[model samples]
Target: GNEYPEDLAALPPQIIIGAQYVQAAGVALGFKKKGAKNVAYTYTGDGGTSQGDFYEGINFAGAYQAPAIFVVQNNGYAISVPRAVQTAAPTLAQKGLAAGIPGIQVDGMDALAVYLVMSEARKYSVEGNGPVLIETLTYRFGPHTLSGDDPHRYRTADEEAEWEKKDPLVRLRTYLDEKGLWSEEQEEAYIEEVNEQINEAMKKTEQAPKQKVSEYLQNVFVETPPTLEEQIAKFAAKEEA
Candidate 1:
């Protein structure tokens, strides 16, 4: 969400995530003022954490005792950039200590571990213990997005193969299989069910009417400003001409 205000002076305290460190911290500060018992959680990749805003957000949260959980998903690489080039810091969690907030590094591949740690952190915040920084050491198996390719240029095949062995899905499946909770039939059925659900969602999305250009202008203000009205008139005149 675009939490940044049009006037920089009007910016609220938040916890900026991903590439939005400043904005997220602004939202977190807002939560602090609202007397929130639970911490406002914001996630950011390793690369994004390198930005000034990330550190600033953490510092502010700690200073004000804002209920904020800063989660760093260290997936080894930020798009094409490897972690080696990202930061010299040995651990992302260590960065939190500078802000006087406890930082915990957890095995991101273990779903239960992450859940438990986060749950405990939430409890600590609710009890007026302040913010916690959690660095989840995970891996991104797929491309950064549909547009990007496997980041093999900076990463070695051996490294990729090693991390693949520790894949969260594979580990979880293995654990379930050991407990007799997973079988070939069950796996197939689960895949089929998920595929059907995804296909239905896609169909609905595709069938939905596309947003018009005018819709963008409508949300910019509660009522059109004089400048916006003039621009709209000019746009209409151009269309007519």
Candidate 2:
């Protein structure tokens, strides 16, 4: 079932957060209360660190020694706001220090490093050491979203170029090539295979039945927001017609 994505027995995601940043703390604590063996993780932006929920969640997780991982994607900018304006802290990872959680900073551009740190963080959480915080130092290669956000308003060309050099794909490919493990032929074949799979999935999606509003709510989260309650009722009525 869609509700049981992946191995439901291994990881049952009971809580789905809405727009409220406070939900992070509440959800993680809920999972801990249930005596879950797996770690619960939540992600927020650099700007989101200012949200009271971010602090509340970390504190709660630390207090109970909940298996929660707080992931902060410091993508340089929180939408239009720059990181410098967000906080004067030496590093975002250190924010967890106040909550009694250990912090690990990693090069967001280095995929291997990010994986290793996250792996260690998860192990720490499962070991009941409490939640660990990970601050991946990355850049927003594009606008915050597909919206009318333009990075040109704040960032300069040189800055973008600097990060561009640290592209995870390039670095990984370069390292693999140096070890005679990658080549242009291999890349082309892999790209072709991935594109074929993506296209097939898109075709399936397009041919699938038109989803009711209620189904949309079930897709990403189990909890429905108050605003969506009315919409869900209306969709149910329309679907019955």
Error of 1 at 200 (Å): 7.6
- For residues 1-241, write the lDDT of model 2, one tens digit per residue: 0122232233322322312334445555555666556676678778778666778788877887777788888888888888888788989889889998898888999998999999899888776677888999988889987979999998999999999999998999999999999999999999999999999999998997765666655444457777777788888888999
lDDT of 1 by residue, 23-83 (tens): 5555566665655543567788887787888888888778877777889999988888888
Best by TM-score: 2
Q: In model 1, how large is the Cα lDDT of residue 25?
A: 59
Which parts of model 1 are misplaced by more than 4 Å? 1-19, 148-150, 182-241
Candidate No. with top lDDT:
1
Off by over 4 Å in 2: 1-27, 30-35, 196-241
**Which window of 10 residues has the lowest lDDT sum in candidate 2?**
1-10
Residue 24 of candidate 2: its Cα lDDT?
45
